[model samples]
Target: MDPTGTVAIRARLAQAAAVIVTITMLAGTADLALTDVFVGGEGGHAVYRIPSIIRTTSGRLLAFAEARGSQSDNGSNDVVVRSSDDAGTTWGAMRTVCDEPGRSLNNPCAVNLTSGPHAGRILLMFQSYPTGKGEGSVATGFDGPYTCRTLVMHSDDRGETWSTPRDVSRQVKRPAPVTSVATGPGIGIQLVSGSHAGRVVMPFNEGPAGKWRVYAAYSDDGGDEWKLGEPAPEDNAGHGNEVQMAERADGSLLLVARQFGGGGRRKSAVSTDGGASWSTLQAVPDLVDPSCMGGLIATSSVGAPCLVCTGPASAKDRTNGQAWISTDGGATWPRALPIYPGSFAYSVPVVLSDSRVGILFERDSTSKISFITLELPSNAAPAAKTP
Candidate 1:
């Protein structure tokens, strides 16, 4: 106890053996395991609607859905497909990428535009409807001439096989009684720069005053001519349906919307000259929900421009899903965590290339759609790093 108290007890036993070897190597890399990738249909109460997961370039984890056989958002629907090689643990059954025999394929958005001329193809946009005789009144839902369209299907391989829903809204200029009421299956993005650089943008909720539009169709020489373009900044109240578009590493285009009245406020718009023109629909402070849909990535992580939003901050609590991180790109979003509290989740959070952060949401409350794999803490420090 003399030599300076035995060198302070050997520096507190080497800082407690470096905190027990850094908590046993983070408990063996957090046992990296997360596997639950269900996609329903076997007459088990059809309710696999509104799923859109994408990760391809050969890494494969594609999911595009709308397989209603029951949970009726309006009878018969189809468009479905699923895949996962190992990343999502396991999934390979469901597959029916658009079976229109009563038309009703909803909400799907995928992109893998290699570059202009459909450079590698893997583009799929969805929204189709036809087959009715009643229960259609949003002022006659476009006054019945029945033929709702918004399709653009293509796959140069990754999705295994596909290519036939090609009526990209046929230069949308509807006015008269050309009604079949359009409501999308909306979400698509691929236009890193101007002059339609590899264009393929789908954003929906069009007819019957459901306004909130964003429709641009272009496939230079790939999906065989899909022209339509002109409605990026048209006047539509902020009630925009479940639209989510993203591409912002300066090649600006952010569009994030969701608001069906009753205080689930989440709205954003910015197109710095890409989706035509937009920027006036703010209010994304804490991101509530109106049937949440989240997936946005504009990352350089901390070097600058960062944005990552994964559904449900609390729309009066649907089990409280979370994942909202912004580094001053979407104009401030301090930091929020909580992956999935209890059940009802609707995630989209994706950021892979080894950076790790993959979330494919929807769970419990019987919605069932999961594939969560998030393990952050490479040295953990980005809550704006304090002490």
Candidate 2:
């Protein structure tokens, strides 16, 4: 009648516009696969950066960083480590917990003593720093021995093999005028609670780069000996550097420095008695970071005693890497959880036994070294089998 019914009505409007554009082009989308566990030139090093993940009471999942042979964070660094008994997916090769070849041990901090008599061995501090022309020019010397020192090593069948460096740096490096003293680009905590239960803390920082600040170094007979506390007080936002710690439930202690020239976010403090003294600096602008380096622990059981933290929530750079929990401990972090979006600077969470929460970062451009695994935000806190 009308030319075959108008050609079957334009072929049913061209198959209803191709099924409405393939159902809105397949709708929702998501794909984020990461696993670069440190690969900037690989195996032999070239540039690794600072990251520090831990979780060994026998459970295993120790990871560290700062391999660098030349990417310039200072120079010829070392302090590599690896191990993952099936947590971060896979990782086992890279060792070198601290190579002092020409000097530049880097900043790798570890801790897993657990209880009293060194509950399970594994305490790796670092900071050899000093290359070529005496690098930071400590006081005015070259050779070796001291010039920004702070070494300490040990591993009892967990980190595999390590135990050579042990220069208390005169207890824990005092006499500040600043030149170097970095133990812990991340990872270190043992105090169980109150009265400094068991103690083993570690979270340090000195100066010579931008006038950094932040101090802490405990032991109480566990890691043998490791004094040095009191220095993290002045933090309106001007100095303080790459620090991180967590020991609270009642014991007292909570550091989280990394504020550079006094920008704004990320400064935290509070040591009731554990870290000796620390109370001034408090900014935590919601865990932002252009100032980089973050990773504070203390997750207790599963809820209440919370205080996570991973970096690059971004205030200016490193992109958006998240996972900032905190439940009234650091005062407020509310519940973030982004983990990798662009570059993601330094990070280190570790609280997994089963509760889940491993975040070992420094990805996007620092060559490699990445990890993720979180689950905390069902209202923001509640679950305590052990964190």
Candidate 3:
């Protein structure tokens, strides 16, 4: 389907007076639309950064971000979220998930449990640090006056309300010799394959700033207990931190990370043992990223296994944001389509059980965050086998 059709669909939805929220059931629905759930600066914060969106099992869409006092990563930041029930046509007011007295709650990585003891439960993981410290206190060992600690919160009734945060820093972070850890800043995954089926996994990275490496914080007994996995082995293959993950059709997890150090290509790695360990890292030379956070979701959208990744498509600049589809797992991402053509920043993708895809991302204007839904064209032939 030509993306040009999106404009017509939006007009139709507006004509019908039906508000589009989240990712609508667009294929058969009479109308389709796109809207921003969070309008940044207007939400009492100077800017909203870091978008992490997910459609709960109950069908509610929760869009989370950091309400920043300034565009910079540090300062008076709070983890806030807006929810939608009618897809994207309407949204609830912004609610603070967690805010510390003098600390910042940054980088929200969340997952809705579909299986296990916490089935239907929504768990959120983030990092917290004193506002004044920022990453400046990032010592190679533990939270040095400013290095952040990992914390978690959950919602039982969709996203209407949340519970108090439980400090899980010990479970996901290490002391001394390891510093500056961050959880996702995007979406996590629930494995439905192999021996580790039903495991909850969150991708995180920590170490010194320039040498940060990725790791997984996963739980087998639902979200009650999370354990840190070995540091991402392929992480050294890339130059930056801030990672995102999706579960492959075969049950393994695929990680696509932003490449730093001149940013010619993205970095990638795979985990076969439910994120407990990772395979060697490699450079995804085809998916060029300009050192920006991206999104990924593995779903049988085309009637066969497919992995869709979203981020700015430019390596030298942050324009021409697009989604790259991989048919042969994560080996090669050849299919690319534009999501936003101008001033695109961080983005996150969620694939519903029915194969509908919803992307929430940051745009260049005042409204800041925008969402769009799309259907992956069906193809019986498997993604052309790649080497």
Where is the poorest 10-residue window by lDDT in model 3?
378-387
Question: Which segments of model 1 are wrong by more than 4 Å?
Answer: 1-48, 51-67, 70-75, 78-99, 102-107, 110-124, 127-186, 190-198, 201-245, 252-294, 297-304, 311-320, 324-335, 344-363, 366-387
Give the Cα lDDT of each candidate. 0.57, 0.71, 0.76
Top of the candidates by TM-score: 3
- Would you give me the overall lDDT of model 3? 0.76
Which candidate's lDDT is highest?
3
Kindly indicate the candidate among 2 and 3 with the higher TM-score: 3
56-104, model 3: which lDDT tens digit per residue?
9878889999888887676778999988786655777889888887787
How does model 1 fare in lDDT? 0.57
Candidate 1: Cα lDDT at 297:
57
RMSD, candidate 3, Å: 4.6
- Candidate 2, residues 243-280: lDDT per residue as tens digits? 98787666788788878866647788888888867888
Residue lDDT tens for model 1, 1-387: 011111111112222121111111211323233344554555343677566776776778787667777666445677777788766656787778778877666667776765666676787776566543222432222223355566777888888899777665645435543333332333465675656566666555454444434444444554566554444443343565566667776677776766645256577777765565576665565666745655565555444556777676566556645556676667766564445545654456555554466677676664667666655433322221111
List the candidate numbers ranked by TM-score, top first. Answer: 3, 2, 1
Measured against the true structure, the TM-scores of the candidates, in listed sequence, are 0.29, 0.32, 0.87
